[model samples]
Target chain A: MMEQPNRGRANIVGNGSVGGGAYTSVRIVGEGEVLGALGCDTFTCTGNCTVFGPVRAGLFKQRGDVTVKGEWSGGHLKTLGQLTIEGSVRAAKLDIVGQLTAREFVETDNLKLQGAIEVNGLVNADQADIRLYGPSRVNEIGGGRIHVRLSRLTAMKEWLKPRHSTELSAALIEGDDIHLEHTRADIVRGNRIHIGAGCVIGRVEYSQSLHVARSAKIGEEVQL
Target chain B: MEQELISKKDLLEQMDISYGQLYRWKRKRLIPEEWFIRKSTFTGQETFFPKPLIIARIGHILQFKDDLSLDELAGTLSPLQTDIRIGAEELRMRGLVSEQMILRHAGLALDSGQLPFDQAFYLYVAEHMSQLLRGEITEQETGALVRLLRGQLPKLEGKLCELVALRTESGSSMVLHTGGGRLYADERTTIAASIHLDEAIEAFKKKLYAY
Candidate 1:
């Protein structure tokens, strides 16, 4: 299934819509849309693109805005601009430099984000390195090695506009090694948890060790 | 009918496992999403799991972590993804079901190219029931059980159901219904033997796909 050979290539040089099917490569140079499910080897989009159905590609790279009405699943996904998915996402590797809004869950093996993310459902990843530049919100986040902090550039921008807060808010966060900064959460549970500066946590539960910054506000702390 | 539940706090403490491992297994889909039951408590919100099922699953994972990868463990542990088809010769060779029993059961011909999942399941359950109720049930009851399962299993796919054998002075009959609740029998009949369908399926898959 991983080897897709001898399939036709779909190319949209201008604004157009292509019916989704198995393809060796799908390249959209300008605005385009996919009508149905697509299974391709590689999908690349330079301008905006919309996929009405699900997509399963080997390597997916998008530079401009992209919206997936259905689920998006692939081996490697790297996006530069804004990305929105109405359904869930399952990718082995996800790298996003801009904003991401997912109405459902997002599961990946490795997630590297430089901007903000809004997920209505849980975000589960094995290794998550999120540098929030804007406000982010998620229902829950769980994984193995989770690191979240406000980017240095965002901190400089927030210093001038102190009223606006660019923090990551989650209802529940559970993992093994967790380091959080400027994160608001209802509950945080992990083995080794470090609550960095500018965090408001309702509760903190740790098994091994816990370090809370003086600037962070915590309602309760329990070591189990 | 309510199932016995263990909270997230107690489960981690009792299992001596970290939250990372639990959530990691969940992400890998080794644990079904429906098992995580959330409810409001005085503290705000709490997550719970069906006590016995979670314990058994975690124990299984711990025992096999050294040998099998998570993907392989998921293939054997996940109940909702049971789509295994075995040939008649392999089934007979594996001795999953007795030869005489397969011969007696309908739609279980030895020469059938491939035995569908449902047929193989029915035969497995019938054989299990006969062994469980050796003295209580007769060959005719086994046939009846197979028929009852064949008609009801499709409708209750991916759900936890039960196969019950009821006997009275008149005769014996079988019934299939969703599990986790008590079944009431009138004054005439008594419940002979009841088998949880999901548990049976899990056990069957473990036997078939185990390395």
Candidate 2:
């Protein structure tokens, strides 16, 4: 167990190791855990790591598996592993390449996800571009520009899954420009709306234009 | 002329309002629930709004944001009217509707002096009698206008209605309708002027009280 501030670069390796302190750069090489709040400039974790408290960093990159039990905020966050956030996450830019499970909201200026994301709360971003690789669920999404699509792998996986339906479920999705595919939402509202293939929507209200794909199912479409 | 609609994105960008601000206003009921129109585009589901109405509303909210809270603004924006009183002299002074027009429509003689009008009576004149002052319709048309509004007043209660005036080659007429009921002036009347009855009344009051 190490409990001290590392001014420069701090690297932890091997199993059964715990590092807790503020550092300029933190690199967790193996199965390392953080017991206290950790603040760093550049935080990279290659092996599985569990952060017990909040984390604030300039740049956070996770390559293996990481779990944060408290709120997390950083300038830029890039995750390519199984990341579980128990609390909200605030970041300027978030790039996710693997699976993300967040209990609360995810607020970011720009979000680009090429994998799966599940959230109990809303995802509020200035701009969000998500390509789902598997079944993903979110309560609500609001932003300026939101584009969600299902990747080929996701479609294949859904076909192979035992469940009959694999569409992403969301209560509401609202934004300026919104395009969704393989999504099931109660209501979708925006300036320009496009419901692509494999979407089941309850109601849609738009001001300018509305285009619905033949494969999509919509209950009602109203132009204001 | 058909009004142009504005895309939600364009409206926010043009007004410099964030998504958070728009949703906050919506949650506060400052913006009517029906105004959030949903449509589908090439991209996905999007929201749209009536361009002029939303612009005016946003402008009013921003202009008075410092003077009033969001709740207060919503109150002012709402069509509900509890107590609205206007003196006949004030109405005449403001030139909302001419004395002769009121005398002819309401049958109030000038010699009887000025009297305060309730919200319904004031709204009736603001909606129908204003056209009389503008010389858009004849004195004979006032009878029909009065009967229509008088009949609808009780049904309206404190709710709002839209007064629509239509002008055709034959003549001009007025109509008032809430969501439930509709009253038309004449069969040949074509709609030329349309406005919210409460808004017309409020505008008249503002003009009268400005000085």
lDDT of 2 by residue, A19-104 (tens): 55678888888888888788888998998999998888899999989999888887899999889999988888999998988999
Candidate 2 regions with alpha-carbon error over 4 angstroms: A1-8, A156-165, B1-211
For model 1, name the residue pairs that clash: none
Q: What TM-scores do the predictions have?
A: 0.72, 0.53
Q: Report how far residue B174 has shifted in candidate 1, in Å.
A: 15
Tens-digit lDDT track for model 1 on B1-211?
2446899889988988876688778878887777788889877788988775677778878888889999888866545433334566555666678777777884543345456556777888888887777756777878888888877777676677888888899888888878579999998999989889888887876565432
Which tens-of-lDDT digit does each residue in A86-122 have in candidate 1? 8999999999999989999999989999999999999
What does DockQ give for each predicted structure?
0.43, 0.08
Model 1 chain B: weakest 10-residue lDDT segment is: B77-86
